[model samples]
Target: MGSHEAKPKVLILGKVDFAHDAWNALTQICDVLNPASTTREDFVKECQSGKFDGVVAAYRTFHSFGITGLIDQELVGAFPPSLRYLASCGAGYDQIDIDACSARNPPLLVSNVPTAVDDATADVNMFLILGALRNFNAGMHSLREGKWRGRPALGHDPQGKTLGILGMGGIGRNLKKKAEAFGMKVIYHNRRQLSEELSGGAQYVTFDELLSTSDVLSLNLPLNNNTRHIIGKPEFAKMKDGVVVVNTARGAVMDEAALVDALDSGKVFSAGLDVFEEEPKIHPGLIGNQNVLLVPHMGTWTIETLIAMEEWAMENVKLAITTGKLKSPVPEQVDLQ
Candidate 1:
């Protein structure tokens, strides 16, 4: 179809460009609108004036918090009266207010790309684990600043280390395979333990046991009410001293302030984080800390994975508009039905 042909009106609220083919596919199917290179205030104003049939809540789109907060809730309410479906490009929609959407008169159908992101997210989990254990942040900084760590002030190895995975989802399972290849033993705590075959012989333990036995702790869970600040001061105290912390999950999953405190007390030897509680804004204390390795929220951001996610999200959008059903709605949305 030509660009001028009638198509579902979609608001592309992406902070970053989509994979080229993904963008092409979207353009071929939807009439997309993007707010200019604008201020958050201006964007919020535009969002609040929503007039599109569907809204593409891109990886980082958000409504203002509360009455005027930017991000989920605010944007959810911003949907035009004609709105039918809202699809977020990423797996976790904790940033999007599913409850509010559920309460809408004819509730907006929502969806996300879940499985498509697993491989890349898992890769990043391992990257973070190794970086944290090896002190890659400090080492890289030292080298860049013209100082090498005389081979002694280096990092630890994953060999024979116990990698405790907090969430045993697809990403967690992939991380297990890779960690095992590096000679690390894996243990996990999940809401429900996987079968032995699914777990590939990785031990399953209670949360407390996972903490005590883990030499390196990796967080791969979602962010929700129960999961918010799940790893706080008390949880930190329970962990083995010098445990390396790696998070490819949500930032709020770990208490950033509490983590810094643990780092200060020499409890957590180091940390590698890809997501932050208040993302794009690092905790003031974490900046300039040599023990922490921080990356922007780019868990599933490789070329291949990005294309898969974008295409999956668009597929959901297409199905929702055509059949009034989503292929992969969030679990809570499924429960509601």
Candidate 2:
């Protein structure tokens, strides 16, 4: 590299809460740019104004959605011609439109932090499973209200129960070992069956078998067009009576209204949810149901996980500027490498 050549520019789409050292180090190699606009409208205008003309890569956080909105066609088109890489600081990239990014002339390659989040997210999934199966939420709420040992229904033990996992990805595989530690028999359904080693003796059942036979159902798949509302009224009707439902994945993956209906009809015994279809605004049905245990999307909320995610995303940015390649390009854009 010639000393006279200008340094490549990198953009920060959201605040770097941790991993300050990595971010600081990145500053030495690339010119870092921060957006002045807070709203989506102003952001688009700012981009069109050439304030980000030389940005070649960007590091974005999940919370940055409030600032830039969806990274759709319009927003992607507004980006400078020099921009080529986008590093998202989370496992799920549903908020981004990969098709739109691919359609661009030079193609905006995207990467996400995957293995960094598996343990934390799986921990939350296990927590929800235990809370829902034991019907602990009602008793906890009752005790909080000064009631003494209110008559909560008897809870089912994880021992000998069938745990049906949808999506045998990293989080699901991690949860399998944790649930097995509680003596639960695990079965899973994925887009395709896993190898014998990866399956770890867990049965790979069909989708229908998973729904109809399991005592507890856990959703851990990514959200996409084919997966939106994948679990709805018709699917719930096939489940065993008094089935426990748990979701730590994207809220929209399962139909919120249908889940409420299933609970109301006594088809589902209880539910534990970390994500909702419309987050920060839960459905009234779920709120009114005493059998439901809810957490506000805290799957990867731990400090350690956040730091790892930030560092992983920064690595992607660093590699993009230095090597012109992403450490973990999204599956959709593997050919872009």
Pick the lDDT winner.
2
Candidate 1 per-residue lDDT over residues 217-295, each given as its tens digit: 9998888888999999999999999989999889999899999999988899999999998878999878867889888
Badly placed stretches (over 4 Å) of model 2 are none
Off by over 4 Å in 1: 1-7, 26-30, 33-50, 53-74, 150-154
Q: List, residue by residue over 215-331, the lDDT tens digit for candidate 2.
A: 999999999998999999999999999999999989999999999999999899999999999888999999999889999999999999999999999999999999999999998
CA-lDDT, candidates in order: 0.78, 0.94
Report the error of model 2 at residue 239, Å.
0.5
User: What lDDT does candidate 2 reach at residue 147?
Assistant: 96
Which model scores highest in TM-score? 2
